[model samples]
Target chain A: MSQDLVFGLYIFALATFVGYQVISRVPPLLHTPLMSGTNAISGISLVASLVVAGEHHDRFAAVLGFIAVTAASINVVGGFMITDRMLRMFNKKKAPALAKAGS
Target chain B: MRESLINLAYLVASVLFILCLRGLSSPEQGRRGILLGELGMLIAVVATLFKAEIVSFEWIIAGAILGSLIGTAISLKIPMTQMPERIALSHAFGGLATSLVGIAEFHRMRDMADAAATVVAVAASEHALNRLTMGSLGFEVFLGSLTFTGSLMAFGKLQGFITGAPVTWKGQNVMNFAAFAGVIGLLVYQVIFLTAAPQWMFFTMCAVGFSLGVLAVLPIGGADMPVVISLLNSYAGLAACATGFALRSNILIISGALDGSSGLLLSILMSKAMNRSFANVLFGAFGTGGGAAAALPVGQAAKGYNEATVEDAAAVLTASQSVIVVPGYGMAVSQAQHAVRDLATALEKRGTEVKYAIHPVAGRMPGHMNVLLAEANISYDALFDLEMINDDFARTDAVIVVGANDVVNPGAKTDAASPIFGMPVFNVEQARSVIVLKRSMNTGFSGVDNELFYMPNTMMVLGDAKKTLISLFGAVKGDGH
Candidate 1:
């Protein structure tokens, strides 16, 4: 394998292990948030799309890149915000009666 | 210097993503995790802008702004009940983006190779697209395309636009397998021949892949959606990993691997919760399969189960010292979570200890029941899992099962003929009195008759769960004696 391919493989393999271990430790109650959180992680591709769309490429390539940038940007921005909104619902209730009940 | 700075920034972003995932392991740190992830994304996007390859920013800025607005609107507009559908739609978008990027990269490099070969010498730069790039890009496009269509199907089912039941015709599996094999054959050819492969070949392969995705998911029943959605999520992650290989981006490699594997883990967990194998969940005929293990005897009238008046249920609840409320998809269908919550609060007023029994696969998605209840403003502390509260059921005064069927069915534990035989169920039968609120004697998602309703300790209260709960609340209030 080429050096670049080998390097990428090494990163991919280790990160897969980390992902499994991290996700497995999460409680069942948080699965939805875990899903949306990782959804945002996949949005990292938005960075590459931005570069591809901005560069002086052929028109066809540029159009493709523009769509990718828009789609990925939506995934990142929407994914994080939605996840944040959901996670807030997971917070402990702060109702005054429940608060003094000594949870 | 600029290159080094970009690499360093990517490295930092990758580290933040790892930390962000770790934070998501607990609910307390979940908000911080999202913020940290946001910061990581911002850093990566800003660093890419400084790479010196970019000549113009107009398209990038315009697309980013427009996309963010739409995304924000979607996230805000979708209700908690519709979260699964919305997530499936987002996965489709992610897969589409990855597939498009792969196609663009392939074409750009192929054109460059063609130009150089014509100007310089025979086969000079024609082979510039190396074997590894060719293979990875081919793999990326295939997975991305499949995920795109598969997730759209999932979205359709969850949104009620399509029938949630598995649509199996004769030779369904055979057709899906053949189409997918064709996509593989084309990918292998492209991988071996590299740039010598025809451009149309790759595009044709992508089209086949999209078809295979739709076929693969169509036969999966709604009961098995958690697994299918999780699998689609994993596919999107794998496509992203391939994209990382194509782009030589470290962040993509790291984050994609994480996203892909985490999705796989969830699928496995979901399958186990349902007490079924991945093959059983994916390929088994499921609800319509001939292996149906319903415990109900044919031609037997409802002889064993007793119909109870709302007053009898009210009497039991008002006098009970300890109660456990089990809410299921029926609760979701009636939008009765708020009513369930109100009932709990009223019971609590009488010093009745009320808690919830949440099965892992209770609603549509994993942790779905929790989200619905959480939206009802129920305190998280009052909820308990099967293991945590199962033992306490026998000593409990009353267990109110609202709109739940199979999860509480004792047949899973005792009936060897049951399709859900090995599935762990809520031990509601062990409680002193079991009050099941049902619209009728209909089976649950598993399409199996619940034996719990007939048990001597159980009483079936018929009607829509929301209306029943409201009536029972009145009865409880007036039961002054």
Candidate 2:
């Protein structure tokens, strides 16, 4: 394998471990937000889509890139917003004091 | 310098995403985590805009603006009760974007090979498709296509646009298997014989992957949607990872892995909560043919059961000191979270301690009940998971199961013959008194009879759960005492 591919595999392996560690510790109460949050971050594919849309490729590739960008943008924008909305609602009865205590 | 800056932004974004999940480990800091994630996304997008290769900006700008408008509207308008459908649709969007990117990359690679071949007067076959890039592209397109259609199917079921029952036919499993195998075969063929593969082979793989998605989700009953949705979440992430490989982007790989692992772990937890294997959930057609047995349990046939009126339930609630509410998918169907909150409030007014017990597989997705209850303004701190509150049921004054059945069923513990036998359930049977709010005497989505419903101490209040909760709310607060 090329060094670049090997490097990516290293990143993938280590990130997967870190993801499991972080995500597994998340309380079930926050699971819905977790799913949506990771989803929004997965829109990192937007970077690649950006290249495809503006790389001066053929019109056909550009069309595909345009649609891809639109879809990914929705996941990023909507996913994060909805996740934030949901997370904001998860509060202790004594919102100010108890939030600090609980954390 | 610009390339290094882009890479630096991505590295920072990766760390922010990690911290975002870390923040989700508690509810108190969850919103802050989401804010951090949004900032990371903003930075990554802005940096990508500075990439040297991007010569045109019109399409990107237009698509981003239009998408932002639609996304903001959706996020603002969607009620918490529709969270499952909202989540499912987002998965679909993620899938669509990843697959389209994969297709575009493949197109570019092919064009590059064609140009090189023309210059050298050689065949494109020998020049096209290095093993690693081709492998990643093939996997990306296949997984992305499947996730797109699979999530759409899940959304339809959760939204009631399609039947929640498992849709099965003769040889359904076999057909699904064949289609899945065919797609994998095409992918393998492309990877192994990279030189001789036709473009149509790749498109055919995409087509088969799309159909396989529908077939895979078709036989999964609504009761198992938590697992299905989680699995789709994982698939969407993996597709993104594959896109990263094809593009040699480290940031994409990192975020994709995080998302993929998160989804996979949730799927595993959900499946474990229901005591089912991944294979069983995917192909078991669990609720099929079980409905016939479920229909056998009707009103008043079982002598130990008490059919209580709204007055009796209200009186019971009013008399109780501590009450625990167990919500199920039924609560979501009837949109009873607000009513439930109101009842809890009334009970609290009377000095009755009210807490919510949430089973892992209680609703359409993981944390489904928590989100709905939170939207109803109930404190997350007041909600307890099965393990935390299962032992407390014995000490509670009364237990109210609203629009929930299977999770509280005692059958899961004592009856080995039961389909849900190995699953952990609430010990509501150990409470002082139990009131179950259900529509008619129908068994839950699993079609298994709940022995708890037939116990002497349990009272079945048959009606719409929302209406019943509302009436109970009135009776408790009416001051006839």
Candidate 3:
């Protein structure tokens, strides 16, 4: 019934629709790069949630915000760390030879 | 009131989520992106709990405690080898959470009128319109539920708990299409009868969606796991976005959207690496029993292949001016990457130019050989691709192959009747001398014996890859060559 509530809901809906549109068109070829990229975005979410929790006067909202903050933080940090470890495998050294043609 | 501050925090969190996504595109700056995401969620959660109107904290506290314990346990227990499975499982959890959120939001909306008599007059006007309005809650529930089941199936398949074969019949595609049609039909019905015939229709749609997940993943084999994992990850993100929409949370919407798009792109990349179409991966029985049944008969005259001892192998390497090493899955299975790297170092010290030649698909997984070498801290410059080093093989004094079978088969390029013919291969036989380390003359995953073994320049160092490499390194060191 409130104008603020209505506006908030509209923003959420618009973001969701736009987000899905962007997601569906993403070519599977770009998955890992995109995942690592989006993980950084998840990190930003964690920061914003923390700041929001700090600024909030309502104890309940702040606590809920904190929980979300923690979850997203773990997702972003651990996700990237694992991704880096995975990427390191793309570089390896060559093997050695066994015998000569005429010994 | 303080709502303004909470709203401001929400806006900021949304912006950070956007930035975090952008940063993750590059390997160099990915860590920063992760940090930004952490900050955003922290802000969002803090702001949400600041709501003054909400009085109860017990439920939230209990939920947080339980979630943290489970999360921590999963995080600590999972091994690096099973990281892909763990990632899929995390996506499943995200999907499950979104689905639950959607259900709770729907229930809350339904009970709103009855619980608060203060808004009865306003409720009557909204109630009449609500009956005709399509609630986001239903959409979120549908998508989230699908994501939850789909991700679980992907995880199971990746973990080897479930078969990675597509369980399809002659009319499987038709059935899948019908399922899609059924979901759409159920969705339309739900929109019209928002409050009526809830249980049966809801359950039916869920079942169809779940079956669709199984159908979508069943056709893909284990070899195409990376693509499947990424695809399921995208589904999980979309589910989260749907939940955000239902709950009217901007932060969730933005973050989920970023995750969803990234997942889709990763899937595309993985598909390209296999040189297969996305549809083929989804429906074709690729890398299944195709390579498992055919066993190439080994040549009885194995005289030329395993004719060299460690000292003989040492003699060849000792005279070489240049040596190029080629490693394969056998290297990984034998845990010989480090040993091979050490041998290369010793060869270089003996005034022999040593370089590593790598094939694109040399190991079990993409970049498997590369990872093994990197773990040994091998210089990045010493590693060369097949195209780059193939020509040099002929000029090199020796080509030492460790625990490799298929990649160096020579049959792939030389034998027209060979099953893997036309597949690109490393020209290991071109080198002046070739030494192969192996425990037996067993054919590789392609189930074909390597023709390179018969080459005059090639000699098999029969033993484990690690042991052979170590012995060869020791011999080279002792010879003082």
Q: Judging by lDDT against the true structure, name the best candidate.
A: 2
lDDT at residue B424 of model 3 (Cα atoms): 68
Docking verdict class for candidate 1: medium
Compared with the true structure, what per-residue lDDT tens digits does model 2 show for residues B238-276? Answer: 999998888888899999999999999999999999999
Best candidate, TM-score: 2
Candidate 2's C-alpha runs over 4 A off are A94-103, B121-128, B291-304
Clashing pairs in 2: none
Worst 10 residues of 1 chain B by lDDT: B292-301
Model 1: residue B95 alpha-carbon error in angstroms: 1.1
Q: By DockQ, is 1 or 3 better?
A: 1
Ranking by TM-score: 2, 1, 3
> Candidate 1, which segments miss by more than 4 Å at Cα?
A93-103, B121-127, B289-304
- Cα miss at B263, model 1 (Å)? 0.5
Q: Once model 1 is optimally superposed onto the true structure by TM-score, how far is the C-alpha of residue B112 displaced, in angstroms?
A: 1.6
The two-chain DockQ for each candidate, comma-separated, is 0.65, 0.54, 0.15
Q: Write the per-residue lDDT of candidate 1 for residues B1-481, one digit (tens) a residue.
A: 9999998998899888888888887778988988888888889889999989889988898889988998999999988878788789888988988888888888877887888777984465534677777888888889999999999999998777877777788998887778878878888898877767888989998898788888888888777788888888898999999988988888888899999998899899888878999988877767643444334434334567889999999999998999999988788888888888877777766667888999887777777788788888887777888789889899899999988887887888998878788889998988999999999876666677778888888989999999999988878766663
What lDDT tens digits, residue by residue, belong to model 3 across residues B227-315?
67677666766666555554455666666666776666566655654446788777766542454324345343444554689989999
Native contacts kept (model 2) = 0.79
lDDT of 2 by residue, A1-103 (tens): 6776898899999999999999999999988989889989998888888999999789998999899899999989999999989988877775332334235
Which CAPRI category fits model 3?
A: incorrect
